[model samples]
Target: MLKHEKKQYKKVVLAYSGGLDTSTIVPWLKENYGCEVVCFVADVGQEREDLDGIEDKAKASGATKCIVKDLREEFVRDYVYETFKTGAIYEGDYMLGTAIARPVIAKAMVACALEEGADAIAHGATGKGNDQVRFESAVAALAPQLDVIAPWRIWDMQSREELLAYLNERNIPCKTTLKKIYSRDANVLHISTEGGELENTWNPASENVWVWTTDPLKAPDTPETVEITVEKGVVTKINGKDMTPFESISFLNEIGARHGVGRVDITENRLVGMKSRGCYETPGGTIIYKALRAIEQLVLDKNTRLYREHLAIDFAQLVYDGRWFTRLREIMMAAADEIAKDVNGKVVVRLYKGNIDVIQKDSPNSLFNFDFVTFGADQVYDQKDAEGFIRLYSLPSRIRALNEQQRKQ
Candidate 1:
């Protein structure tokens, strides 16, 4: 009798992050399958220090080759702005920082695998996390032919401590340790921290848990006001200084971070059937969310705004669940872009000790006519017309009551 043959992928491209999980997987894949591992890392405007020295680490981890691509411009201009245009805030707080980056990164990973003539693609996304859905969904949407590998699902190492020991046993160097076991995802928009003390609802985030922003108590007492300009629904100027897409985000992140802008702690439902707590720092994204929504108010009609708001919730969910590259997301984005077509404006934001307020907003497409709304006087509107409008609006209720009284008599 012939033995059941195990699946074999002679060559595979792994989405390498040089993080604890990916670090171990490179060597593990080589040891277990004897297949060649090609590592690919996409730079999506993450902190330079986090990415520094990653190439050497990938090579040290016994990868056949490592490919690093600069995707900062593409990330900012495409994914970031596209999401920003929708004014969609996930769960009313999350900026979808990690969510927004997934499709672009997955697209890059697939492209690299094809270029390298690889049979399968591998990722470090754990079975439990949203990233697994994101990476796999993008791959499925774009190129479903390639086989996908997820080590976390099949691996014997069940816990972080076990993974650490496994790496230590093999003399493989890793950046993560047991005490700080929080899983973190960082990109241009924000940084998210989960697990560890963050898992406990009553427990406050430790002093060391935060890396992106200062304590609101420690932030400056004086408020800082900044003027931001938008053209065709993209941020064009920051404090009157014209900047590229990357520059604008980087600049705003720095400015907002100093003022302790964005920090959120919430228990959210995972795409999986569990509730998870995450502490996120989205300093720059918070500012942009507020600014864009204000611009939407300035430009869009009341009903258009209301309908788009209804669309935004689904858009946020679709993004959160990693449906970015799918036809559904494409259709949603088309609708969102149409809604945001006239969302062109300048907004003055005040940042004070973690408070972000839209003090002033103006737009070329603004439908707000101050004179018409003024109680003092208005030629554009007749106040007496509201009485007639209200009576007509309640005609059904008035008619029903009159008929009931006539029947009783």
Candidate 2:
């Protein structure tokens, strides 16, 4: 285990969530490192219950002050929308929800630390998880001089029981209990559930694991169609009602959750070189993903679409690996933004039982022309022209076959 000398930090700004782990971290930092702890919370659209009385809880847990930043609109408009434009889905099924939110949260935490004139920034992310890397990498990129204190790596506590007991001994008021079955992270984009029954690969996720979406089997029998408008690959309006980026996601979450629009059970490769099973509910994001693909089909040409797909794969991995603050991410995002400029359209999507189908799509930049592709005869194209075109296109293949025939004889 890594060890830090006592009193190494005069004051530390912690990325506080008011969760059990972070709640315990407040006093732990003060006691172990002899530093004044300042809790910094970023409201990235987590449940209201999570934020309620968070400031009081932080102070009770030994934090000198608590700073909360309302990052909901920025999180969606900057991080979520930009990632959506790239179509970056991690490992095909995962929407990179938890991964995408980390950079934004970390950036906010760093700014808090700097503004507070703190020398170190601490996080509650455990040593085993990807969030530790995500938080530290962003901190390193944005503010290299700030020391990072990860208590999970240096502390002797191994389980939640120990953390709770430590708080109890310190007379800290923590609402967390061992009765909690799942470890969850929520943001505007999605909610992810892990641990408990999810630790076993064979065990299916119970109904209790899902917090945001309805069960597909229990969804309404009648399908609902929604009209979404896209401008430069960003969803601008839904059902012909113009909305802000944050409002759009919030509205879709309500609609998609009822229809069981997004639920993914994935055993993904973690950045720490391990496989972890988790279930994610990303209702609104799923709809936006489908909507964007529908526009791409109508507007982007074959080559540009293919290139964008390749970029998506790389961008997904970059985000998952916590390289969001790096130069590669900037370059890829720029490329994605350029391709997205042509992705303008409106799509009618049908939602039924956890499935989203694009029923109709149209765009001004569509390469699909009804006149050219019509089965009926038209003045635009000649059947005889295809014969010459095919002959020329196959000339290399014909020469290769002829050469083989002559060599065999």
Candidate 3:
């Protein structure tokens, strides 16, 4: 047993989710550090069952107080919508469900720690994963004076079995069983599953791995079309009903999940430099991503659209790497905001067999000129203009070919 110096801090606030790791951590912190542990639970639209009796569990595990705050509305409005506007899909597929939620939660944790006059903040994120970086980085950016105690780095408990034994010896109640052990993180945007059977890249995700979405093969044969209304790149209405950002996303999740719209199994490169296999379900997020993209196709010109595409790649990395509170993120967000000026439109998406098909798109700010695109004779555009334009466009290629001929001679 590696002994920690006792009485290092009089109080500490922990980011608790009522999970096995965090639940076990509550008691461990009190015992090892000899500090009053304050559990701060941020409800960012996770399942209600996870939050049920969480306060009781925290107190029972020796927390001085468990502060629960509902951050769902702020999460969607600020973080989720900003991500949506940036079109940040990490590694060309991930919707950033877990990554986007971290900064806001960390901010809340810092606020709670300051309010409670705690000397330290702690989290259950493992030393190997990206989350420890995420939590500590945000805390460092927000409050540098607060000490971050990462137990996984200092503790001798190497595995879940050891953790369970340590808790059992201390009479700490852990609701998790070894049989049901798989690391999972869920929020309003999506649900992610990792560890357990997902450690093998060759192994296909079993049906039991998914929680929020149905099997695409088992989905109904009939395709359902859902209309999404967007204004300045933010989703406002779904299926013709006006809704807040959280409400709209929640409703879409229900519809998209039933039809098996979004499920991806990826071996993604973690910020910690390891390739982690994770199965993610982002039914609602997928629908919103497709809809906004469809709208942008009509509203933004070629140059603006291409620029946004390039920006999305870097923006995704920033969010995934937990740099959301930095100046780089602010600059990228400003650029995205500029690009989204004309991104006002409505998109009708057909959900079927784990796919989102854009069936219709209409925007008041659309740059599509029907008369110019029509095949019939039109007064708006002259056919003779293309001959001169094509010659000028291919001038570099023609010059290159001429140079090759001269070199051959």
In order, the Cα lDDT scores of the candidates are 0.86, 0.91, 0.90
For model 1, state the Cα shift of residue 271 in Å. Answer: 0.4
* Per-residue lDDT of model 3, residues 1-409, tens digit only: 4446544679999999887788778877877787999999999999999899999999988898999999999999999998899898999889999999999999999999999999999999888899999999999999999999888877787877887887788888888776664788999999999877788888888987998898999998999999999988899988789999999999999999999988999989999898999999999889999988998989888888888999999999999999998999989999999888888888999999888899999999988999999999899999999999999999999999999999999
| Candidate 1 structure quality by residue, lDDT tens digits, 1-409 | 1123336778889999888889888877776666899999999988898789988899888898999989888998899888887777788877788889998899999999989999889999888888899999889987899988888877767777887888898898887867766778888788888878887899999966788998888999999998999887788899999988888898889989999889988888889878888888988778877888898887888899888888878988989988887788888888887887798889999999999999999998998989977888768889889999999999999999999999999
Model 1 reaches what TM-score against the true structure? 0.95
- Greater TM-score among 1 and 3 belongs to 3
Supply candidate 3's per-residue lDDT for 289.
91
Q: Score candidate 3 by lDDT.
A: 0.90
Error of 3 at 208 (Å): 0.8
| C-alpha RMSD of candidate 2 | 1.4
* Of 2 and 3, the candidate ranking higher by lDDT: 2
Cα-based lDDT at residue 389, candidate 3? 100
The TM-score measured for candidate 2 stands at 0.97
Query: Worst ten-residue run, lDDT, model 3?
Result: 1-10
Clashing pairs in 1: none
230: Cα error in model 3, Å: 0.4
Find the 10 residues in a row with the least total lDDT in model 2: 1-10
